[model samples]
Target: MTLSNSRFLFSAAGLALASLLPEQAAIAQSAAPATITVQVNKPGGAIPKNMYGLFFEDINFAADGGLYPELVKNKSFETDDHLIGWKAVKGAAGLESYIVSSDRPISATNNHFLRLSAKAGGADAGFVNEGFRGMGVKQNAEYTFSVYARRGPGSVSGMTVTLEETRRPGPGPETPPSGQALAQAQITGLTNEWKKYTVVLKPSATAARARLKLTLDGAGTADIDVVSLFPKDTWMNRENGLRPDIVQLLKDMKPGFLRFPGGCIVEGITLDNRYQWKETIGDVAARKPIINRWNKEFKHRYTPDYYQSFGLGFFEYFQLSEDIGAEPLPILNVGMACQFNSAELAPISAAKGPNAAGQGDEPTLETFIQDALDLIEFANGPATSTWGAKRVAMGHPAPFNLKMIGIGNEQWGPQYLERYEPFSKAVKAKYPNIQLVSSVGPSPDGDLFDKATFKMRELKAEFIDEHYYAKPEWFRQNASRYDKYPRSGPKIFAGEYAAQSVAIASPDNKNSWDCAISEAAFMTGLERNSDVVGMASYAPMLAHVDAWQWTPNMIWFDNLNVYGTVNYYVQLLFSQNKGTSMLPVQLPGNAKNGADNLFTSAVTDAPTGDVIVKLVNYSTTPRAVKVNLAGAKKVGKTGRALVMACDDLSVQNSIQEPKKLAPKEGQFAVSGSTVNYTLAPNSFTVLRIPAKK
Candidate 1:
């Protein structure tokens, strides 16, 4: 076995692998004084069962009216869990059932359900349930329904809850479309109390595209709470049931891992006001939402739905990661507070002042510890475990086996640093099995660690979160920034990398070209160092035009329509072509006069004898380059190549126009240790070759 001595000069599309060692004919017949050896081998040991992990950021379930099964397409009028104290009122607006979650099991701070009534849409009269949008239910698909509700006083003898679909300005009854209907009875009964109920509805052939609707008709009111619906194929949660076009965009982008909850969610609030995991779970109504710290950025008094009903809670996150085939890496609230604390800081003192109401005083350390335990229990806890039992009750009994748990989104400063250490140690001590991730950077909330690897190591952090929101070209050039990272121990996770932010980033500011080129370049670095980079996940994975807090999200949607921005393709290109066993190949240096016009790197699966070279051309004009395989002892006469390139970098794909950025592959010439071809500007390309004899 022999190794190669090589010094490389890379410019435009040229690859000059100048051997630095004496030539060895035994290994390969090379012409240059710089000797090279490419040792190729067959497929070796088994590869990991999982190659990639992907999924959307979902909190929509908890945001939905509740996790209780929305009685869409059910046989009878049924209520969930909350079956008491709800009274029916005939108002000018119509027959509205007050849904209050204040009953025994429906109290806040955990166990809570809605109190409401159920009846049938008696031809002329009906109940209109608001939308529980999420996980792609916005699109037409097969759905299952369930709920936990009970009948109240004076129930309808033969009441039914019919499923109907209508637009926001919805049409009237009779002429109204029937999505699916379910009717149940035993009405006109029960005293002040709470009972459980369940119903299943099958879609008629008439069922088409529409959101879930649970209509109670034929008179009588029943207290209700907790409802949920299941769709065969949809987004993990409602928040990002973003359109398929956008999802497919992400699938195409080979990001190593997703860092989320924020590019800003890290701005930790005071102790009581932190992202309480308990509040984030089950039933949107029961889960009081919170204001987004970035709310001020929108230039409007907008509240962020961050106080998510975690119905799509920790377990759901894991499910989403599993569904999308992306690893789950979510942030948990670590004690230290990181928010805008100025003159107002005194009021919200840890235990004194007005802010003290929420975080002036931190939670009892015991509560913090319990929350951490609950988080883990939800991830890998057995079905019978406390939180795990709830998960089983929620439907998905199996554990998500969460591998990465991030503590504190963004908590910096000496105070936070002091606090973070304990949280870090606590998390590590408790969940020795899972990898603990730390945030570094001034996110909207605060706790951003340091750039120096030593500082990161000083904290004993397993991983550091690196975020970037800049022009596309910045992404391109900055992608290589990690190459020179001289650190061991704590790996890097590109948790929130994006080209644009709504208020923080401008779409018009950065041309689509910059987005494409920069992101491509950035990703190349992440892939090159996948060994050191455990994973990468895009931030603002989605944006609702009406609900957008950030611009240039990986996926964006408006109601029924959706689109993938120009930057999305960068992720798609790498995700689709990612190879294991990252071969260490030195790219040729910069172009003539040191112009960094092109970037190149190669990875080979020594076992499979397969070689992959990724060429990123960031120029406006097309450039030709050659991949030098001279040092690669083995060389084949011919091989295949897959390229994902577009004519223009600024050209984006919209709902009205998809396929604008998809990849189209073609075979190029591969002769000797060199494979040569033209690379379009602002484009990403991947080439694969076989090991020679």
Candidate 2:
């Protein structure tokens, strides 16, 4: 039978069966022992190297507060609201402060600096910066503090910087700072010329709600910009680096590709505010900051202070990809704004040429296309090239060796095609080796998706990016959505997807076991069709517990702690166990649509000579599956099974109970060629069995 017809029959039969007896239906389904036949020697196709990875967007304070690790917000005071994160000390008498904008600024992009003035004997005058939901400091951990300062006026001896713990009384308002100081630093040198001074302070105690205070000592005015504090033990110990704990979670996943700088951030709220790569390179201070596209995305979770520091810019992204041993996949705007937001279009004239009828000083389609070309040069061009020279000046003389570029993110319709066509052609004509990725809108099924896919196929695009945020049942039902995809069309990049427990972008959505298990069932289909589906990743990778704008992120973190949700463990299992080649697994009398609540996929590790079988049981009752390993000379008796199971489907992991739904490992014995394993209900399992030589 055809796949669709089979799916229909399965659904029909399931519905019919459900009408009989609800309680006995599950029992009846589990009564028969399912038989799975695995052909270990017959491999179908080689899996893509970048089969599973991460999609990082700047949403949910992932960059500024969660990962980038810069304790101070509004460091350069460049925002329209310059003093959003800073507040003057209440009791500091005769002290005044304001932001000073300069024509001859520190950098062309960063033009604002904080200026403080204090009268004689006004020693206590200074400002206090409340970090992103309060800084996270560990006991005895050394934190490096730095500031760009210059002597302004009356005799100023130096500045005293202190890290103090602040208390919150009940839930009303935050109380005054306690007398205890976590760390302190003294900067004595005051010169007329601007200079950067650094000091290290080891905190005597740990505090999750720590605040940074800067006070003037001898009464004078001092100009300060780029006030920053970072834990010395960052990822790789690099100055101005990412949080080690957060990076460690990503490192443990063994991701294949790292898609950086964002989902919607690529296509900003407006064309003028799109993510410009050139502005994100060079010096950290020079890298201009902009309001995050997600700043006020959701009305309920509106965060006006959210902005992109660009501290974790393209350079940092490339370096991080290299450090994590994953391919760097950067998505750029195709001269089109986010359709959901502004839907602004760039001026383009096919008959009149590249710059014809340009929109009065506004960037034309050619400019956007040129940005793509310049980005390629910046990433892979020789040192003599203009953009390449800038890359070298940023410290890395070697090219980042970018292999692929995504044209847009979840974009659709004729306008998207009009933009994508020229961008892809230009990129391919210049750099034929670099592959291009196209998008099929946000939803998996729609008229826009069909239109985009048809156009992409006509253009012979290399890859087509697809996104889906659906209900848990939708994921389980659509597991075979790609089975009917044409084998000769553009490959697939299941870029941004997550199973929403409640609804898309709803605050009520959760990273629950039901959603994770449904995703596992869907991922099995992705793995089975690895030839067509080259890459896939979960959306909104990280979220801050206190300041998140999105729900059901893979990883959730607070000030001092982070925990991976059940979905994280599901992705981790598939990613870490991604074998080299796909092996065929046959199930007789079992619905391919997983109507029996059993989904399975098999793969063989060519180098290790092991057969890995992934199985997900979605029923309420346990299932006993008899697996027959055919075409194998000898099978190892002892094998390992990793199972992620929970007693309740709605149970979720939190900061306090991180490992509540983590995987449990156990040894299973395989008798001859027939292995009988009992699969836990509502659980995902992976069995790695070796082949004896």
lDDT of 2 by residue, 524-610 (tens): 999988989999999989999999999989999998999999899999999999999888888766468476778889898878888
TM-scores for every candidate against the unseen true structure:
0.72, 0.92
C-alpha lDDT of all candidate models, in order: 0.49, 0.83
Predicted candidate 1 versus true structure: per-residue lDDT over 1-693, tens digit per residue: 011122222222222122212222212222221211222232222222232334244322212222222323211212232221112323243344555554565444435554444333343333334332322233234454545555555544333444444333324432233333332222223335654444444444332234344334445555445554454334544532323344454555544444445433433444443566666555443555444445434444243332333344455555545655666677765555455532112111233333445534435444555677787787678987888877777567787767777766544554545555666676678778788777665442222344333466876677776666665546655656666675467777666666652234553433254566566666667766675676666555665545444456566554445665555555665665565555554444432211365665555654567677777767554555555564555666555555445545556666666446655554455567766655554456777677643
Cα lDDT, model 1, residue 409: 58
The candidate that achieves the highest lDDT relative to the unseen native structure: 2
Distance from true position, residue 502, model 2, in Å? 0.8
For model 2, the stretches where C-alpha displacement exceeds 4 angstroms are 1-30, 97-99, 121-123, 169-179, 350-360
Give model 2's clash tally.
Answer: 0
Model 2 misses residue 665 by how many Å? 1.0
Worst lDDT 10-window in candidate 1 = 1-10
